[model samples]
Target chain A: EAAVTQSPRNKVAVTGGKVTLSCNQTNNHNNMYWYRQDTGHGLRLIHYSYGAGSTEKGDIPDGYKASRPSQENFSLILELATPSQTSVYFCASGDVGGRAEQFFGPGTRLTVL
Target chain B: EQQVQQSPASLVLQEAENAELQCSFSIFTNQVQWFYQRPGGRLVSLLYNPSGTKQSGRLTSTTVIKERRSSLHISSSQITDSGTYLCAMGRNSNNRIFFGDGTQLVVKP
Candidate 1:
């Protein structure tokens, strides 16, 4: 089983402020992902990484950046947060190849004021 | 671009009643999965039936790849089963997965 934990379970940020949501997984999976969940929008992938030092843009990557400093860490950064960016964010990891199972984190709720 | 759509945006059920959830995709995919999520809680994978029928406990998932659709059937629903059901499709081996908005379920005892 994958153990995906995220830091700062809750957050509140002002407009134009910078926010960074950190995620850590102990599953040792090769892939990691960041997503935002909103009403009627479900989960939209923002960024993903294959391994350390690798980041790829997902479906909705605007106004967001991702970092994979190590196999156990993946982070989502909002350089200049806005009210429109407020939503619950999730981090996941897994092997999408054979026997695919993508494990999800508890999620981080970010509120941009 | 790929899109996953779940029908009956919301549902209400009584104890011991049966429930069915549907998921349809706009693109062809061999990767299909079902998940359960409690209000403000983490997601729990229910089934990973990509192209066939699979069952786990009282839950059954069937996928028709050619139709790009899948269905999840839960027998004898319980209050503990009240939550949102999500459907997702794996885009690639790198874990590129897309999810539907989800169908919120409320079970009354």
Candidate 2:
């Protein structure tokens, strides 16, 4: 099975602080994604990357930026965190095609106070 | 407008009972996937049935691309099955997946 891991599984930050969540996958998948999960919204995509150094905005990309520095590492950056940004973030890695099954990391829960 | 919709926002079931979940898409899609998330845990892919029927263990997923709908049936529910079930559809144009609000399931012992 594919292995995906996220750092700082639980986080607490003051408002206006910078928060960065990191993800690493060992499956060597070409596509990686970042998403935030809320109560009613389910999972909203923030950003995704096709490969290293390529980033594309997803349905909900505002207030979040993504970086794919390498094939195995993808990161989600919150430059200026706010109270409303407190939510659970997930990282996923998938193969090249649309029908490919995605493998997700454990998830990172961020609390902005 | 929501691209994907899931029925029964929440459901409570007794142990040994069967649970059925439904998912419908508003747009044309041939890629459908089912996921399960334990309470405060990671999202785990259960089935990737874009079309036809597939089964794994106690979970069975059937997808009808032409009808733009899919269903997941869980037989003999257990207390460990309590969590959220999410359905997602993939867009071929942009390679983006849209998720439904999910069906929260609670199983009673």
Candidate 3:
């Protein structure tokens, strides 16, 4: 089975703090994505990377940045966390094309106070 | 705008009964997938049926590319099957996939 693991399964940070969520996939998939899920909005794409050193903004990219330093790792960074950023975040990896299935990590729950 | 839409935002089923979920896309797409997420759990891919019909275990998924719609049929639903089912649509040109709000299912014994 494809494996995607995320660090700090749960986190709590104060407002204006910096938070970094990391994701690693052993599937070696070429595409990785970051998404945040909320009650009303469902899952909105925050950022995605085609490969190492490449990142693209998704539908909701404000107050968020992404880094893909290697094929196995992708990270979502919130330079200034806010109470509104408190949500469950998911990371997924997939094949080069959009036709393939995406494998999602366990998820990270962020709480900003 | 929500490009992907799922019907019956929520559902309640008795054990051993069957459940049917529907998904529709506003834009043309050849990439359609079904995902499942348990309460307070991660998302898992259930089916990747771009077109035609496909089955795995007690789950069946049918996609009609021309109609721009898909359906997931869960036979003999169990309590373990209770979860939020999400449908995602992708385009051939880009790697981005759009997601629906999801259909939350609850199974009662």
Instruction: Return the top candidate by lDDT.
Output: 3
**What are the clashing pairs of model 1?**
none
* Model 3 agreement with the true structure over A1-113: per-residue lDDT tens digits: 57999998999999999999999999889999999998887888899999999999998999999999999999999999999999999999988645656889999999999
- Fraction of the native A-B contacts that model 1 recovers: 0.41
DockQ of each: 0.56, 0.67, 0.70
Candidate 3 per-residue C-alpha lDDT over B1-67 given as tens digits, one digit per residue, 9 for 90 to 100: 7899999899999999999999999988889999999976899999999999999999999999999
| DockQ computed for model 2 against the true two-chain complex using alpha carbons | 0.67
Of the pair 1 and 2, which is ahead by DockQ? 2
Considering the two chains of model 3, state its CAPRI-style docking category. Answer: medium
Question: How do the candidates rank by lDDT, highest first?
Answer: 3, 2, 1
Q: Candidate 3: RMSD over Cα atoms?
A: 1.0
- For model 2, residues B38-109, the per-residue Cα lDDT tens digits are 877899999988899999999999999889999999999999999999999987766678889899999999
lDDT: worst 10-residue window of model 2 chain A? A94-103
Which candidate has the highest DockQ of all? 3
Question: Between prediction 1 and prediction 3, which has the larger DockQ?
Answer: 3
